[model samples]
Target: MKPIMKISPCILLLLSSFASLTSALTLTVGDKTSVCAATSLIVDGVLDYYQGTTYGGTIGLFKDPYYWWEAGEAFGGMIDNWYFCENDTYEDLIYSALMNQRGSDKDYIPSNQSLTEGNDDQSFWGFAVLEAMERNFTNPPSDQPGWLALAQAVYNTIWARWDTANCGGGLRWQIFTWNKGYDYKNTISNASLFFIASRLARYTSNDTYAQTAEEVYDWLTETSGFVVSSNDTTNAYTVYDGAGISGNCSDLSTGEWTYNYGILMAGCAYMYNHTSDTKWETELEKYVNGISIFYNTSNNNIIYERQCQQSGSCTNDQRSFKSIFSRCLGQTAILAPQHQSDIMKVIEASAAGAAQSCSGGSDGHTCGLNWGYGGWDGWYGLGEQISALEIIQNTLVLQYDAPLTNETGGTSEGDTEAGLDTNDVTNVNEITVSQKDKVSAAIVTTVTLVTFLGLSVWMVL
Candidate 1:
């Protein structure tokens, strides 16, 4: 008869620890469900639902009724969630948002509001669509004048408006607005252009996109004076806010935000991957290091907008900044694996903190703005939910073993397994599992043999 084997107390304790660590590192199905529920709540509560004769869509301009730029940001977050979860529930909703909100022509105008010409705003929607194309979420098929076409159209619009007359060669903050700051050439707008150009360059294998990325980078660093070189070589370059009417790049606003650094970081990473240019590598490293300035000292790694986040006075625009930063940072990590460890440390820490801040609400879970505080601050909005969802999804992306394959069938080079393999039982204390299943079987067999030998000796005695 075969003898029964038993696991020792020591082995049991080791397995417990191993399981705990794995659970801590990996997101559970429950967590994903909660995040998805929160997303649905945000969409249902905040977005304006209008059913037209031709089509219907959800408007994300909850804060500013007419401002479709914010809608673009919300839509971007939704796309990220869709990619991470791979749920087709929001697929039609996304398509509706893009089709209904955009202009009739290929212009990609977000809304019909007059003087709504914020180049950055248009670029945000375009960039989101570009991401959709890359993820294979676009309806019309990426190859045949689909999301890629929309993204390129937006790029062309921005390219056409390039102001050599203003800050030398940077895009303006607003394309055509009676509002102030139209003349202001901010770092975000130009960095967005740089990011789009670099990504487009990679996707199309076109030299023009690469050249355009370089042009934007040079204009920001050298011409616009946004990038301030450090005295020490090891220290990465410092980027400042954009210039105003004076058009002097050196006349910086000095208000540092995470998204600005993140955009350029991603752009440089893509450029490096596409061109194998060491300069882009250097720039990527600089921006990665440059993001440290936004990290809260007391918090483990919760990023904050240095300008008003400390005082809890972050505006609607400021509230959504960290998510953008987090998304781009994840992209950079994928493009450049060498920096993954350090980048993951920051990302994991922030995710942990953000997850802790979710308090029960009408939707079961609503996240707040200040994750560093580790508690809900009595505020909730679409922007807050979007930011939390981004961080959570980014954490999943980082934790997953396999590269994420979106609906479109395209896969990233860094894709691997979905999560840690539990079958391989190695040393639980050290968490070293080399052929874990085989090792576990061996341990069980040896223990059973030892028990059987002890029983035989007792019987003989």
Candidate 2:
């Protein structure tokens, strides 16, 4: 049963009294990490970091979150949580435990249960992180030189799978068939790939990448539109090898579509950011508007559910996935501040509350892990939490200040005249400084071990 949104007369009177407290809730920048950027980076690192640590491979660029449950799906099933077939690992929990244990009294270690099962929420959470870092780092002023080289490597891996069948306006499968070369195309995973590719194109300023991105994006749009278009339903409903395949191509899980919409909005934002292409921006606008409409009508809370359990009682009741969409909204706010109002406070609150809850555990590390579980349904590292934190921080910025303006009074990319609204500039600036410091600390810790290893090797020689 759905929880009713009822307000009693007495409760209403009490709410009125506390209204001042709510309105006075200032979103000042603090020493705390910015929820948006922090979470994105963490997600990227934890998701992919384990690949190098355990698998000796670059994280596979295209893999859907949840397709294994389908009756005929081949790539979905596995015996262990290591998920050797997909390079999944327990490293994320280890990192999270370390983050919390650092400079703390109680020793908090995630049980071996951390390696229990492979889930998509954690995958997408990580995917969102990597996607944002690669795209943002590759673009203009904040040119992270290291990321360029990294992007090249990941981009090549994605390109290796490109073929005649899945090349133009077709699905790109998340998990691939090694023997067949390149046979399957998972629609949901392909959506994320398109978004990632588009961001890569913007960062590298490569037309071929951009062109391919547009093709994939267009294909996904044509097919995924909830209301089917008259032009082409074939792309929308492409089957697995045959017309009567047990599970059709359009058989997408709600969780999959949630990530799909998120990356779509983000990819579109990146496209506009890099190309200044009105067409891409216009296309993204349609999705943002459409999603907002559907959400409002449904009273849907994407983060409130514990997995996709359709049962009366759930073993784990947690909130997940909403942060990805919220982070996407933050990206969109940066790209097009005018549309910020279109996203409701509920989204921001969901992201913020989830972040706070996740991070409020016994210590920072556990807080992060809990946040990951709250938002993604599995073990989380500091990196994923940092990414979500950055988004939350950015959302708070939009809510408290004007439509759009960084502390530098500089406008976002193409829009120079529209400055961020800062009613209390000093307080806001202080908050940003504090958050930046927290984020910088997290980055240093992650890279510290690698730096030390390199030094040790030099000494040995």
Encode model 1's per-residue lDDT on 1-461: one tens digit a residue.
11112234454344444533431222332266654554454444334322222244344343322246766776777787777777777778777777766664545653343245476787778777777767766566333346666677667667766777666788778765443577688988899988888887777677887888889889888888788776675577787888785835556788788888888898898888778888888888888877887774566777767877767677767777887888887788777888888787787677666655444233334455677765544445555666666676676565443222232254322101211231122211112224554466568658866976898666445
Q: Give the 10-residue window scoring lowest on summed lDDT in candidate 1.
A: 422-431
Could you give me the TM-score of model 2 versus the true structure? 0.47
> Candidate 2, residues 1-461: lDDT per residue as tens digits?
10111224454344445543431112223223343233333334323323223444322211112111110111111101112112234334422322322111111111111121111221332242233233221122433213233333334334444433322334334222221212334444455557656755665566876877886666565543322322442222211111111233344433323344565777777787777878877766766654542243233332332333232122211122343555566666666655666553545544554454333211232222222233222233332333344334444434332221123232223211111221122211111224455566557656865775675565445
Model 2 regions more than 4 Å off: 1-145, 166-171, 174-184, 223-256, 293-320, 344-347, 355-391, 396-461
- Could you tell me the lDDT of residue 90 within candidate 2? 38
True-structure RMSD, every candidate: 22.2, 18.3
User: Could you tell me how far off, in angstroms, the CA of residue 262 lies in candidate 1 after the best superposition?
Assistant: 0.9
Segments in model 1 whose C-alpha atoms lie over 4 Å from true places: 1-66, 141-144, 231-234, 360-364, 399-461
